[model samples]
Target: MKIVVQNLKTGKVFLADAPKPAVPDNGILVRTSASLISAGTDRAVVGLARKSTVGKALARPDLVRRVLRKVKNDGLWSAYKAVQNVIAEPKTLGYSLVGEVLAIGHRVEGVAVGDRVACAGAGHANHAEVAAIPSNLFVSVPQGVADEDAAYVTLGAIAMHGLRQANQQLGATVLVVGLGLVGQIMLQLCRAAGLKVIGLDLEEAKLDLARKNGVLIAAKPDDPGLAAKVAAATDGYGVDAVLLCAGSKDSGAPFEDVAGHCRDRARVVVVGDVKMDIPRNAYFKKELEILQSRSYGPGRYDPDYEERGRDYPIGYVRWTERRNMKAFMDLLASGALDMQVLTTHRFPVERAAEAYDLVIGKTPTFTVGIVLTYGPGEAEEYKPAPKARRKVPGKVGLGIIGAGNFAKGVLVPAMTGTGGFDVRGVVSARGLSAQAMKERIGAQYSDSDPGRVFDDADVDAVVIATRHDSHARYVV
Candidate 1:
């Protein structure tokens, strides 16, 4: 099976051909039809891949500071390597995919062959043709829910869980920061719940799109008096809840802007990346309640609970994150909301590289939702990258798109073992990545253009470990 992976070093994209994953007894094998690219989480990932060593250190100054403190007790090189390894591991993109069940493992009941389902859990429900997903996280796709619509279920669930956390009543005023796909969906969900919604973002076009979708008030991120505008819209009382759906380099601190704008005792639900700085003055004065909205709710990050067969008692604790996914899908099936306008772009699996570049470039041409399509297939033999060097005596040609730390340290290094795959031509839009990868992997040539590497005859096979947006294009 071929999987799309990000090169942690150069931010170059690559396609890896590995053994087909075996289905666990509690999981099902899904032949994916469509997978959605989560731009926010993935964009942060691509940006990390483009950073230099100094930039990485600065990005994690807190970690660096902590490491410095530990280095006095531990060895300096040891702490640095530990941090490097943490950054070097490649991350899989896409947790939302709609696919047909090709096979089901024993103990997985209710689902059978040919059943269509939407899967959650990253890496398991990746942007690939086939995935092995645990039974508990898999939800059946109702006939009313189209494949494209079903692919967005996981994200919709995220918005749903945020709403549940906010506990807003009808006619309540709300604010959603970051009018990206997730924010936009939250706006619609808020509107459906009879809440007045205000959207915020840097892009006017996205604001305009949100306005069209029922957000009456859309404000720029840089507006000095933006919180005032939100307050004015709320009759000077402030919103009942503020949902943070934007991703940033800062720690996701809900006590900053939310504390000032929220009404006394108003709730703030954080769903995106933002730094959390608790100001005692504000909290003591207003008594604001800050809540973190986990992606999969209580089951999130619990390998034993979410991955293994250990579900919490349903009667005692209703609506786990997995249940939220079902609720969102059911809402879609019932026509309470629509996702057609949200999906903006579609690509086949082969054009995966272009998809990654689109996200990495942060292209303004098209911004909403993007989907990658895959046709049914078994383990297909990959034509070794054509441009890779096949006649280097014992060396082989390789093309890598992403040059992030993971690619540079692991994948690229793994490909360069003695008598193993030779690192040939490399492609990365970033000059630093291309140059750095060329040196580290001993590539015969390096180019900023992916086409140059793709078109090269010396390249044996392409290895794409770029961004989530590119997974579909390259696989096609």
Candidate 2:
């Protein structure tokens, strides 16, 4: 299948052909129809990935420390090779996608083949032609919700998780910082829950979007009367909670502003990328509580819950990531959340690079929910054709899955220089990558299905250059 990947060393985005991922025992194989680009998070990752090694190390000193520890414990040569391997591999992007179930594993239940579902999580619900998503991360999309709108389910879940962290009651006023896509959804969700919502952002266009979506009180962070506006909105007590949903290079100013607007003993929930430099005096005097909202909810980053499909009991954990997705889908079905107004742009999967450009501000456009649409006939089961045997003497037939950075930069280049190996086929999850690699390598065929490589009779050996999590599955 075709997948979108970015070169960590160069930050160049491209498509690659990868073998079709196997359906796990506790998962379903989804044929992707639409996936939403999380502008804030996606841009941040892309930006960081594009930076130089030194810049990256400076930006993430914790990761540098980990690398240094590895060098200390292990040999420097091993650490160097490990870092080289990681940088050489192309990283797959995207987390939220809506698709139809092409197949299901034996342990999968509640969802079946042909079910229209929204999938979440970083690697599980990637921006690829097909994804092997655990049952817990897949939520059935209601008939009323369109696939394009359903793509927003993950982002909504993120916002929902942050709102839940605040734990504010009805009629309590809450301030939402950064009115981007997540913040906009958060504003609507807060309104649905009967909480008074006030929005703050640097972008007037986003603030305008919030106002159109029924958020009455909105202001810029630089406004001199911002504190007064929050005071008036909350009847002089200030906001009961502040949900910081904006991403900033330096979050000190935003943190200070949020602190200034917050009421005494109020809660501040951080959902976006912001510096956590809290002012001791302000926090001490107000006795405010600071909480960080994990990506989705309780099950986030828990292998037992997400991967093993073990759900938390309802009595203890009210909302897992799956429940958050369901709640967002329910809101969309019930017309409580206005996804239509929030969806500002749509791009075909072929032009995904251009879509990223727009999100990163290369194209000066106001966008909220940018959806990537796939071509028709993507939901069908794949069947690989039998490969013809190599007729040339002393030549070995080669079929490769995952034509990303490692395949193109190292593997393919090495194979090309080798004497007897013939490049028979190249497959990627992304059509662009498959086609690009095929043309560059002079391969006989290029496909989006990995089964093609496995079934080819001419192919003497198969190469797996995909992500670490997929290595074992591809080998099998």
Candidate 3:
């Protein structure tokens, strides 16, 4: 099996082979159809990994201070060595995975083999051809839900859980700050809950998407007279609640616009980072209720509830995070929510690096959600080269189809370092990336059309790293 893993401290990802793992006790193995790259959470992790040694130390000065303390007290360099060891480890990427169950382990019940399931967790649920996830994290996909739609289960569950925490009533007005993927999901969920959704973002493209999707209003965060517009939309009563879903390096700062526009005693649930300072005067005047929503429900971060076999008290808290995923899938299966507009791109497994590059570079074109795909025979056992093409003697030629920064920084570097493979060619929709890759890696040729790479006689293996929408086509 081939999996994409990133070094936790280096933000470097490599496509490497791993043993086809067996289903362990309390877990189930699934063949992945699609997985959503959680932009904010995963990007935060990637960004942390990409930070320089000095930057990391600056960010976590306490760690450095602790090491200094050890140096002064015991003359021990162990803390420095420990930090280096911690930096050397690799972290698995992804949690929003939808796939079919291939096998089940001992003590795993309720879900059968061949069942379609949405799996979410840190290490067990990942972007790979196959994953072994704890049974507790696997939620059955309802009938009629497409694999791509089900890929949103984890994120949808997150939005839903946050909404639940807010506890808004029908016809209540709500503000969703930051219309990223999660925020957009919250918008849909809020609409489903019969609440008014006012979407906020800096990008007109994102706000445009929200408006097209039926959000009550979409506006820039810094638009002058924004409070008046929101007040007019809400009949001067202010919104009943606000869900903060913005992500930034320094997101802890209060969104002054939200504080200004919210009605007195309104509930505010924060799902993303924000500078968490409460102005006593503002709170005292408004009597606002502020809350923070965790990623999963009661089962979140609980080893016994999510990782081990122990089930929680179901009667009191009926919907665990897994159950929330089940509810999300049910909503999709019933046509209550549509995921068609959310998925922006797809890439095949071998070209995974290209997918990461797009996310890192923040390419404005053809971007929304990015998914990595793997076909039935895409494992290490089979090469992605054309079956009809004859193998070249002494040359392992590769055809790369994505040329984003991630490819430039990590995967391409790894490919260039491969002992036997020759960087034969690359392709992108536009010739710019292809040409740049040709120059950077000394590829023999480049083309804007993928067909050229597919037809090239010298290419022995084709690596797909395009968007999610393109994955099925490339795989087929």
Candidate 4:
């Protein structure tokens, strides 16, 4: 399988061939048809990866502190190797993908093989040929929703979760800042919830897009009469709630600006990455409430809920991440949310690097929701490369299941340095990582399916370097 990956150390993006991943007992293997490129989130990650080591350290002081703590607890060589592994590995990108279930684990239910579903989460739903997704992070895609549109389900769940945090009622007026992909989705959801929606952004084109999509009142953050516009839209009471969906390094100005436009005791929900330097006086005087919306919903980042498939009680937790995804798909099926208008570009998965260039504004055109398409036959069963005619004797044949940072920067280097191991193959959920590892180690084969490694007669040992939640399953 072929997938896109970014080198954290150099920020160079490229394609690689990897093995198909093994499905966990509570997960399913998906053959991706389409994946959504999140401009804000993914661009931020790429930009950080492109920065110098010092720049990265400065940007994430907390991470530096954590490294320091590791050095204090562990020896310097161990700490150094850890940091090296952290930056040297290639990272697979994309969190929103729609595909068919090629196979299901023994414990998986509700979704069967050949079922069309939308997957969420970071590593589990990456922009790869095949992804091993936890059962709770995916939802069945309705027949009416196209694969391209269904790819937006994860982002839609994010917007829906942010709205849920606001807890607004019908006929209330809400202000959605940003007007980007997530903000645009929030605007449509607000309208569907019967709230009068006002959209704001720095780009006139985005504001225009929002207006075309049922946002009657839209304005730029710098508009001198912005407060007055909100006042007029809300009959002088200002907006009942503010959804801050904008991504900025410093959110002080936007928050301060919106403070004057919010009614007394109004709620503010931040759905994007931004510095939250709230003005004490404004929030104190207005008695405003500020809340932060995590990605998706309640079950997000909970391993027991997502990986182990232990669902939350519906009575106590009405909307888990999976339920939110389902709701978004339901809206798509009911025609309440139209994702087609938000999509501006589509590229084949082979041209994924160019797609990222578009997202980063290297291209001459603009895009809001970019979808990466895959051919019908792109998800065929894995086939190992032909074996070498002559093989080295007495070398321990090794196959690694993940080619991520730890595997690439630490394990592979150590194995090759020892001069006693022959790396037969490298397998990663993303093909790019597998391909990169194969090139780095001069391995015979790289694949997206780990089963190839296990089945190989030459492979005497297997290494698992995946996430902690996946380690046990891989080990077993």
In terms of lDDT, model 3 sits at: 0.77
TM-score for predicted model 2 compared with the true structure: 0.84
Candidate 2, residue 153: how far the Cα is off, in Å: 0.8
lDDT of 1: 0.76
Better of 1 and 4 by TM-score: 4
Off by over 4 Å in 3: 61-75, 249-251, 362-366, 378-476
Q: What digit string (tens of lDDT, one per residue) describes model 1 on residues 173-280?
A: 988988888898899899988999988887888888898898868877567887778778889998888899987646534456566677888887888876776787
Question: Which of 1 and 4 is ahead in lDDT?
Answer: 4
Task: Note the Cα lDDT for every prediction shown.
Answer: 0.76, 0.85, 0.77, 0.86
Best by the lDDT measure = 4
* Higher-scoring candidate on lDDT, 3 or 4: 4
How well does each candidate superpose onto the true structure, as a TM-score?
A: 0.74, 0.84, 0.76, 0.91
Model 4: residues >4 Å from true position, as ranges?
382-384, 398-416, 426-438, 446-476
Model 4 per-residue lDDT at 242:
93
Q: Which wins on lDDT, candidate 2 or candidate 3? A: 2
- Candidate 2: how many backbone clashes? 19
* lDDT, candidate 2, 88-112, per-residue tens: 6578889999999988989988887
Model 4 shows how many backbone clashes? 10
Give the candidate order by descending TM-score.
Answer: 4, 2, 3, 1
Which segments of model 2 are wrong by more than 4 Å?
Answer: 378-476
> Model 3 over residues 1-476: C-alpha lDDT tens digits?
56677865667876754434446578988888888887778767777678898887777788889779867775666545444444543556788888888889888888889888888887777887878888778888878888888888788888888899989899999999988888988999999889999999888888999998899889987888788888998899899999998874465454555888899898888888676766767767899899988887778998888878677778989878887888888889778788888888888877777777777764546456777777874444454433333444687888898765556545666776766778777776434446556765677766555777787778888878776666787764
